[model samples]
Target: MARVKKKIRQEQLIEKVKNKPFLTDEELAKQLDVSVQTIRLDRLELGIPELRGRIRKMAENAQNKVKAIQSNEVVGELIDLELGHSGISLLKITEDMVFGKTQIAKGHFMFSQADSLAMAIVDAPMAVTGVANVKYKVPVHVGEKLIAKAEIVKVRGNKYFIWVKTHNETQEVFRAKFIVVSWGEK
Candidate 1:
């Protein structure tokens, strides 16, 4: 069999995202007709962190609420909470929620949504990320609303471990465990 041509380079993918009004790994993958993982790998090789990560970094640097709020890209509202320890966020996944071909929104999107809520509960000025492990259970289609409930599972020293469960239309669809480090004047 003859040899096949190589795919596009990482730089090319970055350029594509930079040119698009709304850049996402999934959208990029769909446009390129490649797998989401492929796009992730390309981003990694090019030293481009995930969108959520970038947003977190920006939030950390902001000096005021306006700048900080601008860092949030997820769409949702805080329904219930218990300040300074744990809380829950409710969100609806619409057609616009889709980042790529995946129906359940990007992993980073969920992570960010949960992270922001966790931060709010802690009432911290800035938080640093430590670790996160997420499991996708079902596909979240367009028009399906989801509720992501997160709570502080454990706190050791300055590290806070948060557990998040996502429900879609009365069904559990995703779950995640995150470790966050908060730095603020006490």
Candidate 2:
């Protein structure tokens, strides 16, 4: 009976990680109602890497596909990319990114994350932002994770229109529309 339960729990663990690969061992343990050590052991048995390993694999795969900019130039960790179409990035708000008293993240950090994501989706050797229309919908605090997604809306000549929306865990915090110009090829 105990072995059967363990097998079932392991199956649940696999499914949970598949649905959300970024979950940490502590989070997984909480969700599974098991100890952190048990979660780690089960992950080993199931041949699953930890959260950082999983993120590194994702970043490596996405970085190889980037063309407009070097992967390291991305303002956040580039996790998904389809050149000329769409891309996604993740940013964690740290102490240095927020105001000293307000504890609210600086707007430039969010804009940079969105703008860079928009630039990355352009399939060109050189891409530069021509215009940016942005709005900060809500304030984000330190220790929060931000996910920015960018999509190309239209293309004309060497100009690309892209939209980026950034969300914290609970709600959308920022949005932008970018006009990008790209030329030549590397």
Candidate 3:
């Protein structure tokens, strides 16, 4: 990683954004060995929007085909959805989501995201997490974007077996197997 120097880093930042627009300011700062403020300044000078802006723009352009749950009820911004099959969502870790000292995000947030994604993919009026076998593969820090992908493995009566994996880019951070029950099912 090149230490981003004054004036020189702007060009590099532009290239970086072009290659990976999903990178947050904190991530860019880490890659360039600069402060987050410096990255933000460089991004601003380069005429690049923040990560949230990029995500929102992408989300708007990419239509969600099937929405089993209310959009607001989803744990993260639903990027794609195919009812009764699979779905994808993205969540950005923020200050409130992490521990004050550790800077590591709370496990519940990850679980909630995965669980909600799993429930949202089910073809039902209402879905609830019945039991979850969860695993945390890595410590997720604040400012990281977690992408949760959920797929239904099988359906046994009213219980749906779902698998969710949350990742930070290519690295797996969390995974869960959930047994979800639809309220419509008896």
Best by lDDT: 2
Preferred candidate (TM-score higher): 1 or 2:
2
Error of 2 at 70 (Å): 1.8
For model 1, give the 10-residue run with minimal summed lDDT: 62-71
Q: Over 4 Å off in model 1, which ranges?
A: 1-75, 99-104
Query: Per-residue lDDT for 3 in model 3?
Result: 46
lDDT digits (tens) for residues 12-65 of candidate 1? 677776554235788778877779998888778777778766434433433133
lDDT of 2 at 74: 95
Model 2 misses residue 12 by how many Å?
9.5
Sort by lDDT, best first. Answer: 2, 3, 1
What are the candidates' C-alpha RMSDs?
Answer: 15.5, 3.2, 8.0
Cα lDDT, all candidates? 0.64, 0.92, 0.83
Give the lDDT of residue 162 in candidate 3: 97
Compared with the true structure, the alpha-carbon lDDT of candidate 1 equals 0.64
- lDDT (Cα, 0-100) at 155 in candidate 1: 85
Off by over 4 Å in 3: 1-68
Better of 2 and 3 by TM-score: 2
